[model samples]
Target: MEQEQQTICPWCMTEIVWDEEIGPEKHCPHCDNELSGYRTLQIGLDQDDQAEDEDEEDTSDEPEWDAGDEDESYGGNGSAWKDTDQGFRHTNRAWMAVEETLRRVVDEQEEAPECPSCREYMIEAGKQKLNVEPTVHGAVGRPLVQSPIETTLYVCPSCFNTSSILSDKDRERMLKALSPQD
Candidate 1:
């Protein structure tokens, strides 16, 4: 038998299939992002990611699996969901709760990499915004040009240099950088 082709949601990182029958503007059932088949992702299935997999195989523990869902074999405390210590839990939540939880989990787990302005790998940073004072006047009235300030800068492991995800200010900097080369 041929193996099924696998596609992943860029937003939720949910494993999906390229169902042409579903046509374009496909949204992730988990994230509901309008998609056009360009979402390429490599989902990490390391040991830390195994809880999601193990839960699938152990649906016997799921509440809705059996008629009574009372698996006498389980010595569990009859908890609704068992914590896998993976920061992920398997549980039967209401549809709304599931959607909200999935969104939170995906937003935290999915990798967001790209320069927002150039759409290139030129910069990297967290989503948080940080403001910093460029300088400070010392107590003796000596002017300090720089301080230990937050830049919302993330370091590129490759170059060991820090940069921010392209912002309006960074876009202007990119244009200035390009003008000299042009």
Candidate 2:
């Protein structure tokens, strides 16, 4: 038996195993991105700078410590009013409260759908009620689609693309309505 070839998707970091009959996948299943090196970005430090850094050593003439340097404060030990001020404490507390609220909102969200364009996890914005007649071009007969369909809106943080999917309640209703009758 021939061993299957495996390739990792660069967009979503998903491991994909190619089927023998199908050969290799052209696009990633997870992120729907083309499996090509054109989209990959390479980043590294300059080789010459790295070599120079490795060869160089600390050669400062200044002493490591000076007993007379009492004016300097290393770790906020100086008499800076902002460091111990009540206003700063209040601001910090307000920021902490905002962070906690954001954390709670994130925790409450059950689904974070990946954006089709940028492969970034999308944030659920809110629900939108769309009222329009649904039509299918290839279907033999028009299936009954619920009017004023409710959909959950998603916003991609990276690309700022907006997309919507049928809400859970409406999706279930749609599936049941479209299913073949026994």
Candidate 3:
């Protein structure tokens, strides 16, 4: 009897057993990622070396500031600072526009339903009417669902999966009707 060798997939964390006749697997069966260490990465750091490097400030590239030097690049004439200020203002304006658009798209619903397939927030597309037979059972005892029940349709932007939920009015009516009678 021989022991079977197992390799753990780095991408999906699934344990894979190599077959005796097939030898070792070159790729992970679960995630299909290469098991040959091509996609793997390792990082190491020394805290003492990092602390020493941080303590030594390298100012070799920086130009010395002098009051007599009136160069525009050295901020002596204030042109560098003005250019930086303008760039900052432009960046802020662009960021503000992006935030406004995001707010309009994402904040439409306070409690938006998540798509079952992609787990992304679904946007309300439109209303749909479902014709249900009165003889169909709504509950164990309750028969007769209201015909032409209205439902709100939602579409997932990411996966384009369409789903529907009962309208607020119809949901309330169904809840009230299903309540146990005194």
Candidate 4:
């Protein structure tokens, strides 16, 4: 059986099935980026040494696939979708969650937000729990002295550096927890 041709988009890094039906002037379906100058890429495909060098020259400063994701498929969640005659079906609920998370991550990647420390594109590492103590009240008034601070963590894919920022509601909650009761 012949395998379908596939390539990663230069702009969004989305894996796409290369089809001539869309013609050469086609744009990437995911990011709508132009595919005119971009070369078709496939995994395990043999190219001459010159072609390899050309490929490297064509691809520079591209958002590489995360080292963690390189070994795994479908965001390392083992999630897959099957197209039934009826429609489509997923393996499980966990797969659905993984799919959603992957979509969000890709969307964020397209935005190309730079990390403050490294000046490299930061990827969302998801939410993290932080134990914070009340500054004003301490343990004197409030029974629940220490609480969990939920914040979104963004990690630099290049440097492996990380930074977290809390949402407005989380900041307000932390302040309220620290405020002394009259």
Q: What TM-score would every model get versus the actual structure?
A: 0.19, 0.41, 0.47, 0.30
Ranking by lDDT: 3, 2, 4, 1
Q: Model 1: per-residue lDDT, tens digit, 1-182?
A: 43455667776778876545554345776778765656465767576568778877877744665556565444344443343334565566687685575446435633435444444333334554454454433432432222322334544333445554445554564455444342
Q: Name the runs in model 2 displaced over 4 angstroms.
A: 1-104, 136-140
- Residues 1-182 of candidate 4 have per-residue lDDT tens digits of 44567777787888878555554436888888886666776755465776889887888685767655643434454343222223554368887786676557757653445778778667777878788774644475553334676777787766788887775568776677667777
Candidate 3 differs from the real structure by a C-alpha RMSD in angstroms, to one decimal, of 10.5
Please give, for residues 1-182, the per-residue lDDT of candidate 3 as tens digits: 66688888877888999867778898898788898875644555657687678767664665676666787574787768777665465457887786676557768864478899999787788889988875645454665357789988888877889999988888877877677778
RMSD vs true structure, all candidates: 21.2, 16.4, 10.5, 23.5
The total number of steric clashes, by the backbone 3 Å criterion, in model 4 comes to 0
Q: Identify the candidate with maximal TM-score.
A: 3
Query: Candidates' lDDT values, in order?
Result: 0.51, 0.75, 0.76, 0.66
Clashing pairs in 3: none
Cα displacement (angstroms), candidate 3, residue 18, comes to 5.5
Model 4: residues >4 Å from true position, as ranges? Answer: 1-106, 109-113, 137-146, 174-182
Give the range of the ten consecutive residues with the poorest summed lDDT in model 4.
77-86
The superposed Cα distance between candidate 3 and the true structure at residue 33, in angstroms, equals 8.6
Clash count (model 2, backbone only): 0
